[model samples]
Target: MFKDSKKKLSAPATDTLLANGTSFEGTIEAEANIRIDGHFQGDIRSTRTVVIGESAVVRSDIIARDVILAGKVFGSITTEGRLTITPTGELYGKVAVAALVISEGGVLDGTSQMIRTKDAEPSASTDDSDLETQSGTRKDRDTSQATLQSETG
Candidate 1:
């Protein structure tokens, strides 16, 4: 019925889980949340939160609304909301986020770019999907060895 369809549209998506001892290698695209407690290698794109459990080992590029890392990640991560790294987490790559929370004992061995909503004008929205996507050539800055950049509409 129409009522059921409406409910389904508004209801939260069921989270996808990869339990311990599992290993996945490829691209993962999801509209719902995902929790990984095993090993993953590739890219992960999601409209919802992505949680990497304490026993997880991830090596990929991640794009999501929010990312919670309590394990190890080796790649780039872009988050429109908040990126939280727990005490036992270790991240070894670049990160772009609106907000970042790193707990004690957490280690981030790369640069981070803080996306500013005010600077992203015209659209007046900070949603990642609203921005135009483009690939580019790299330019070395005189700053640190690491480079952080923000992409907006």
Candidate 2:
């Protein structure tokens, strides 16, 4: 038997609201999603996603899979996947992420570097080819080794 409750049984879990009246100063770790509407003064680390609500004010570094900001943040941010700044968001920090999106009215200060984690590893073929090329350059190696020996002597 399935029946709907007259009243809402549970609240949505995707969006966690730290209402305006609350203030926290510590690291926040969550697997789902988090939204802050209050003042926070610490690091925010998550495996899922994070959203800084428009009324929220944060002053700490952030690490997450994805982050959406619509508030004020005064710290560096590192995202494994993507980072999005909404029109009302104001961010002032360096950002390292795979991808970034900033709305027209969003404000971002400091540098942003897009890095690919998987691509950082050299391919097997490339490594092998590089090794082969280096090994084939006998003259270069000999000259360098000779110079090192002379300097030591």
Candidate 3:
């Protein structure tokens, strides 16, 4: 059936799990989602999502499509999709994400850069993305406004 085929295509094949009391140190590269409940110290690169459990502690750079943090993290994070920090989550490093959600009790102590992938990388010379054009024009207008204000004042 077409619905069955679509469901199969959308489902991920595998997911990695790091249970409580476990510890890992090194770079982790996976194509599936990784859920960490223990301690991890190193770089993590995944095309899928990375979920840090409530008891987990991660101290490394994380790059993934999506990231859900319910624990403590102390390094840079880059997500192409969305980054969700739960109420119990604590983040102490810079974040680069297209979208981010922070719960009421979550704590973030670093800078956040909202990255528009289409703006940052155009497909072709003729490809005109609205975000890119808007951002460019906004930058130009800001610069011109600043110059005019300074000159007049």
Model 1 C-alpha RMSD vs. true structure (Å) is 14.2
**CA lDDT of every candidate:** 0.84, 0.85, 0.89
Q: Return the top candidate by lDDT.
A: 3
Give the candidate number with the greatest TM-score.
3
Candidate 2: worst-modelled 10 consecutive residues by lDDT: 6-15
Looking at model 3, how many pairs of residues clash?
0
> Which residue ranges in model 1 land beyond 4 Å of their true spot?
1-14, 118-153
**Higher-lDDT candidate of 1 and 3:** 3
Clashing pairs in 2: none
lDDT of 1 by residue, 42-77 (tens): 999999989888999999999999898989999999
State every prediction's TM-score relative to the real structure.
0.69, 0.69, 0.71
* lDDT string, candidate 2, 68-131, tens digits: 8889999988998888888898999999999898988999998999978797756667677778
How do the residues 41-142 of candidate 3 rate in per-residue lDDT, one tens digit apiece? 999999998988899999989999988888999999999998988889999999999999897899899999999878677656555587789889999999
- Per the 3 Å backbone cut-off, how many clashing residue pairs does candidate 1 have? 0
**Poorest stretch of ten by lDDT in candidate 3:** 5-14
TM-score of 2: 0.69
Q: What is the overall TM-score of model 3 with all chains considered together?
A: 0.71
Clash pairs for candidate 3: none
How close is each model in CA RMSD to the real structure?
14.2, 11.4, 7.3
Could you tell which candidate, 2 or 3, scores higher by TM-score? 3
Better of 1 and 2 by lDDT: 2
